[model samples]
Target: MMGERILPGSYFQYPPPGFPSVSPHRPSSIPTDLERVYIRGKGSVKDSVKEEKLKDKPGFEHLNEPLHVLVEAELPKDVINSRLDYVVAILENLLKPVDESLDNYKKQQLRELALLNGTLREESPRMSPTMSPSMSPFNGTGMKRANYFSQKPLI
Candidate 1:
């Protein structure tokens, strides 16, 4: 009876204003948050009015873990020294004689320098190549004349 009341041609007319007859759903790959909302026949509407839409969403908190550089393989050892005991011994043998010779030469040179500079008395017992003739114990007055003892009278 109701179908007979409405004209058959009226059934094919467009849906009432602000209502869609059938709506097609979007695929899952599309994100819900977008700058524009699209309709099939009409291009799109600006989504600037969505500030309130996001007000109820949860806020994100920062995680506490430290950031680090990525590495592909294990690091190599960083040892700083060589381990041969003979190297130390060889160094000792090579170094000791030179150091000893240097010290001995320094002492001898300092002694000779002191004698040359006259800090040492000329009468001091040290004999040197540049010592004066009078300074030597082997010189004229330094040697005693052979003592002639009168044990018996000379003829």
Candidate 2:
């Protein structure tokens, strides 16, 4: 089964370039506090040494200090409700122009539809008699009649 290998031995032995290799010195024991552990970015060994030196400096040392709690003052319910009402009034004022434009568009559409119906009604009487199959010249005739030519050919 090893002879018919789907992957080569070198694939398991070495990782691809730009990736970090597995550390040989990794401890078998697990740490109790995961939150205290700080993870470092994928950087060079020289960069890690430089960071350690910077941490030892007095100016950069304050970053290691514990964070302070921030206290916020509670807002009154009346002030919050007043702000919401002002926002709603502003939104309604903004939408008034849009509502007016939409109303004008709807009126224009109704006027156009009325004009179209008026034209159709005026043209209907002239179209109705011509459109019927029984009113056609060829309806009673057994032979097909050529309406365009004056005389029928001796075919």
User: Among these predicted structures, which one has the highest lDDT?
Assistant: 2
Per-residue C-alpha lDDT of model 1 across residues 11-116, encoded as one tens digit per residue = 1244243221111242221222211112211111124244334334453111111211111111223311121222233322322333433554435545666776
| lDDT scores in order | 0.32, 0.35
Tens digits of lDDT, candidate 2, 32-86: 1211112222231236567566765666553344321111222355454444344
Off by over 4 Å in 1: 1-102, 105-134, 149-155
Question: Which residue pairs overlap in candidate 1's backbone?
Answer: none
Please give the clash total of every predicted structure, in order. 0, 0
**Cα displacement (Å) at residue 35, model 2:** 35
The TM-score, computed over Cα atoms with residue i paired to residue i, of candidate 1 is: 0.16
